[model samples]
Target: MTGAIGKPTPYIDAVQKVTGQAMYADDYKFPNMVYVSCLRSTESHAKIKSLELKKAEASPGVVAIVTGKDIPVPFGVLSISRDETAMAIEKVRYQGEIVAAVAAETIEAAEAGVKLINVEYEPLTEFFTPQDSLKTCTPDEQIHAHTKDHKNIHKTAELRFNEPEKELETAKHKQTGNFKFAGVTHGFTEPHSAVAMWNGDETLTIISATQVPHYLQKNLSKVLGLPLHKIQVKKPVLGGGFGGKSDPFPHEMIVSFLSKKIKRPVKCTFSREEVFITHHGRHPTEINMSLSCDDGGKITALDADIIIDGGAYGSFGVVTSYYNGVLLQGPYLIDKFGFRTRRTYTNKHQCGAMRGHG
Candidate 1:
């Protein structure tokens, strides 16, 4: 109690929230605003054989229809791995990937339009786990073509100091462990939502419930081919991010593109199921850990090998590939230490930052 900086302080915005006076992204209203709904892919891994949108374009009250071809540029939170398109262009790496989007006068019309769009997919060999990805495969079979040696391995991070394996052999006590972890998602009450408006001067304004507005703005510029100055991103009262809303999502780009094309404000809000598909959460991992202790109970060495599941795209998997092993080096002292982490691309929701990042 003596070290407590202040006595039980209240959140500054708690009063407004309790009074129901706070504004979330979905709370905004505008004249002639349109609603958007996406047609997601049903296959885990597949090539787009064909996409027919005539029915959707002629759907009742439908105003705009956009697909991957409309916005081909890729965007992600990290620059090196911006591998996500606004919608599935050539292929979809995971189930529930957005393939097309519709904008209409009413939410019902948008939903109806989404169902009218027709798509044909050629199913490909899918890898669902890190073990499945590590196996040798044909170049065309790999999830990402750029990966070397025809493997699904996205990243492999290793660090070594003072030969931990040799040191552990000479220790008085040594313990080894194999741990498995399941994936987790942020289940916030308020779903993800965004509203995009194209100003008269060819500028764009986006209001979203996000934690990283600046990052979103930068990514929007990349995919939309608009200059940084032409796009303005605003973050509303976030119900909670927990790092889930930190990434620049495909839906954000989808809504903005439709708004500019139709010259009207477009709004998109996800259902709970859609939220799960856009997951950027902790990586599911299997870790092999070893620790050594001397006769005097002093720590001697530590070594770990981790294999993490990085579904679909590389969100924060690059950093996570290192963090799973590197973080163990801190807050403790060991004479010898080493670790290796291998991240594999899988056919599921891509993982990114989350609470603890474990």
Candidate 2:
């Protein structure tokens, strides 16, 4: 009944969406566009020992093949952590890390080429989820040796707002709850896909199904080792994103690297199974809440203790841990707030930002 920021208006593309006239990234077609297949690492934790590309390179209609070594740069969605890669060259932390990619004249040929790539794996003891990781964690054992902390904890933090301890002393009412949300996929029927072309003049153009084009442009530039200007990322009308397509995807970069190597257009569209395996989704959070209120029902304090199962890598978990506290501070008036969130790394599929990410 009071002030709302802006009156809701009809979506401009409502017609296109309703009538099935929407042209998503997968809908675009180009002459001589080559299909690409990305080979994902199935080992939850293993070192890539070797690869044999002779058969794949010689396959019929196969233009070229690219692997982690083809693109040396390692990058991530956050500027703070640039540890990820288009393909995992040394060790794969997750089951779906891209190990190799193939580009060919036809989709079938590309898929066949992927099979031809020989990837040798050296097995490592696996940890399934955060609980498992913490239980078996040792000073010598490392899920990510790159982390500043010695343990498998990807990131951890404790933050407080105003003064919570004093306010709770006189509060009349107190309540608390334990909440848990399982990992949920964005489930945008149209799966993640991208078409990348290497322009003859030292530039690459990418048409991807993504939410943050500006971010993708920057991250892709980091991974490709190309200047930001050389890479142009265009996001066509999306069937759905729901925060799934916000980050710079490894598959998208795989296509770009393959396109660069082949000097032709390469397109990689994720299969439904691949979509679940390769892409990052919501993190399962276990939250404990506490609240303090006065006799008149005036709220005095709020506190949240959250543990996020940050599968494998630090996606938005770096910030989600903080957001879980910040985002819940308002909506109900509280004088003081206190929060402590810890995000731990696991061996499952990595958790990135998703709709209702917290």
Residue 95 lDDT, candidate 2, scale 0-100:
87
For 1-358, candidate 1 gives per-residue lDDT tens digits of: 4766867866889998999999999999899999999999999999999999999999999999988999999899899888888898889999999999999999999999999988999999999989999999998788888888999999989999999999888877999999999999988778899999999999999999898999999999999899999999999899988989989999899999988899999999999999988999889999999999878887889999999999999888898988899788678888699999999999998999998885
lDDT of 2 by residue, 1-358 (tens): 3554587766889999899898888887787889988888879888788888999899998888877887878777787766677788778888887888888899999999888888889888777766666554554356688655455777777878787866666566888899997888878888998998899898999999998899888888877788998999998998787877777888788888777877778888989998887557888888898888877877789888887888877667787877877787768867688888878887777788887767
TM-score for each prediction? 0.97, 0.89
Error of 1 at 30 (Å): 0.8
The CA lDDT of each predicted structure is 0.92, 0.81
The parts of candidate 2 lying over 4 Å away from their true place are 1-11, 14-21, 135-140, 162-173
lDDT of 1: 0.92
Relative to the true structure, candidate 2 reaches a TM of: 0.89
